[model samples]
Target: MGERIKLPNDPHSPEFWVAVRQAQGIVGPVATDTISALIDAYEAAWPGLPRKLADSTKEKYRQSLRVVREAWGNLQAESLRPSHVQALIETLGATKPGTANNVLDALRAMCRWACGPREFLSRDPTQGVTHFEQGEGHKPWTPEQLAFASDNLTGMLRRAYVLGRYTGQRISDLVRLGWTDIDDGGFNLRQKKTGARPWCPIFSELEVEMSTWEKRPGPFLLQETGKPFTTNGLWKKLDKVREDHPQLAGAVWHGLRANAVIRLRQDGYTSMQISDAVGMSIPMVERYSRYADRKAGGQAILLSMKERKQDKTVKR
Candidate 1:
């Protein structure tokens, strides 16, 4: 019965109920068109909209949609209003702003699809809902913190840190990075979030670290079991180590991406150069490297005058 229905086999889901009814050869209305039913239909609509989205994105949507279904599963899909969506967002946004935004995004996607060719709903309920304002995002690891982790973190955990620092790739792309992706130049990446293919050159520091490590058969980074880690698995493993060490409390994996930008900028790499190397947009590269750029500008201003140079020369 589970095999017949392509959706998850959870008996609590409306899809499961509908599947059960059909399997039992029962007559009458199988199920009403509710939010849960809409979700089931959307997910099952293969060669359809969900197929166009990345697996990670679809998973996120499923998570958010599950929350929506639980809240309003019994309500008719067409009857849903923007006010209801706004209230839900406000309720969740009160505590988990990020999660509330994710729910809003998921509903917007579903509602757009529903209004389009799918026609699941006549109107979009999440039409006017606004996303919650988020903070500046992940904090970059300082050079001192990076050095501490380098000296202390052991095995694959250390390798994960180094890999993130050098590659500036997302955890999703990092996990998928294999030994086969390496070449004479550097690492080859087909980013999961964006389809952009970026080439990461091997920095001297990264090469020195890589030389000390064993050449694994699969991914350059691996679990203790010698298997490639899932994105969340790697995060949890690294985060546990971060929590144990007080210096690394502020360091997150994604922050390494910003650290990479800062490092590049400090080394005289242009924003365009960093963007191309890291698979980030120029605007994002500029955003991440702003401090480095400002520092460079300040130094240039201080050194631009002959008097400052003469004073340094006199002191020397």
Candidate 2:
């Protein structure tokens, strides 16, 4: 009633906002205004992130930030309640658990960066949020499904799918795969996500797929103009391939990597060996293998039960 509070000029800087909070008595319209400015700055910074990160990873971070802002932009940063974060996560879970977790992680980082290097909040809102539980039933595909999809695929898509399955390279890496990357008995390339170099032995099946494509100097996977396929274009091609085989419409591009992991286990590769071959961390290999092993075990149990039943019928 006596006087209106004024917000700091550089609200985006944590130091500026902290000083404003300390001197201006942190409860009122000014604090709220400062929080709003911080959010605006965060949103504005999203586009520039790609300059510092890979295009694929930058897109992921941008998507995560967009979800968070859409859910909670109106609220003051300090006033963000646990219920608010929970609601955001629940909404994200409707689409994907992994995506929801990624959003939460990005939000956590933003909060930490905005507040200070040290923990500024009294309690972390996302501390106890539960993520979706995954199990072996999430295996990529059945042999029948794989065969059907492969048989229906053609052109670049056919090669792309087969390469992904056999090499276990991500879509980003697969599209850029070139003859130069392939050598005497294997392929060597650095993963865009992890920047780790992995050398995968060329299997006979993959060799057949490679033989189908002509050896060229430009991008291994390209459009008619001979340019490398963008992420969206690559997915669109895969989507078209799925359309031809309706049974595979639900299959994701990354599922090829999962299929490779399952095949590796079936071929007696240890988790560590599979992780090394796929250029993934030990933890990721272990997590993915859990599902593959569970599926394999279930199949073995079913086969054994059927055999036992046949034996009992013969004895009778």
Q: TM-score of model 1 relative to the true fold? A: 0.74
- Name every residue pair that clashes in candidate 2: none
- Tell me the tens digit of each residue's lDDT in model 2 across 74-185: 6655677778788888887887878887887767755655544423444556667666654443357667778986777777777777888898888888877889987678
The number of residue pairs in model 2 that clash at the backbone is 0
- The TM-scores of all predictions, comma-separated, are 0.74, 0.68
For candidate 1, lDDT tens digit of each residue in 103-141? 999888877876865566888899889999866666689
| Residue runs of model 2 more than 4 Å from their true location after superposition | 1-52, 70-84, 87-99, 112-125, 134-139, 149-152, 194-196, 281-287, 299-316
* Cα error, candidate 1, residue 67 (Å): 2.6
CA lDDT of each prediction against the hidden true structure? 0.82, 0.72
Q: What is the C-alpha RMSD of each candidate to the true structure, in Å?
A: 5.5, 7.3
